[model samples]
Target: GMADETILLADDDPMIVDPLALQLRREGFTVHIAVDGEDALAQARRVTPDVVLLDIMMPKKQGWEVCRELRAESDVPIIMLTARGEEMDRILGLELGADDYLTKPFSARELIARIRAVLRRVAMDSARQASPAAETASDDDVVQLGRVTVDRARYQVAVDGEPVHLSQREYSLLMALLDAQGAAVKRGDL
Candidate 1:
């Protein structure tokens, strides 16, 4: 599974880049190196690596910019690496759609673990989206709420073609309540 992954490591420091690249390659990943933000963007557009390890501070563009730009074009997973361990930087990176964050002076083993986790999540999400089970519903799908119809597959609720927006948790709770066969359902049952 690791053999199918191409990871882009974008850092300006050669000392940091060299060792990490070697370790990632040793783990059977195809590694691509970029020294700065601009080069990172270029390499991403070229190779479209499965995952990107981005340094916060780099020339031409910063990590935040690269993250935003990449997110606008593709839903590729990003993990921001920063030397600063400030809370604000971590919050800001997550707000910019980075899937994970790592501080510098981190161990190669830890970095590898983080990479595996992010990649696994991405793979699981893609699998869920592609699975036909997500498109079809069982015969027990509908929940009667006095006069409402809920279709879980299309994530839609309608009362005679009028749409209602319900969060996933809300929908699940409502369905559980409706399925109680006229008996009261406890709050913890949700």
Candidate 2:
């Protein structure tokens, strides 16, 4: 529905990469494979894919390092794949700015669902940012939420200047709720 998205699949194993690429293609994604971290990074910069499916272990560059480097350059959504199932590994990946993670041996259906969820959130965020009303509220615009204040111009949110990072959806939802002026926001509104 969104222009037949492209995906970069980074894994060293042909067995894994081949089948995954085929499955993704059957589901309408144009897939590219990278056998190492350096190749993955290079391919990502070259193609500017809609999403990345990154495996944690590989020759030349590990997935975590690749994820860090990628985050430094772009905000493209990343979903990490790892054979390691430790809680710390998952936590570390998220801390490095991965959008999501899937362990090895995961079902294709679950992987697809995760990809769709991340893409939906990203699209929603993009739309909210591009809204005309949001564009008009340049610097010095203050949206008050009880004791909380969102300064649009400065891209800051605070309960008296203590900063917070609210997701685009959270910010939009908060604005919608405030605009209702204590009236009930129907489920359909969200």
Q: Rate the local accuracy (lDDT) of all candidates.
A: 0.87, 0.86
Which segments of candidate 2 are over 4 A away from where they belong? 132-190
Candidate No. with top TM-score: 1
Model 2: number of backbone collisions: 1
91-161 in candidate 2: lDDT tens per residue?
Answer: 99999999999998888888888988999988876876676445334333777656788777676779866
Q: Which residues of candidate 1, in runs, are more than 4 Å off? A: 132-190
Backbone clashes in model 2, listed as residue pairs: 139-153
Screening candidate 1 with a backbone cut-off below 3 angstroms (N, C-alpha, C), the clashing residue pairs are: none
- Cα-based TM-score, every candidate: 0.74, 0.73
lDDT tens readout by residue for model 1, 29-142: 999999989999999999999999999999999989999999899888999999999999999999999999999889999999999999999877677558544322334455
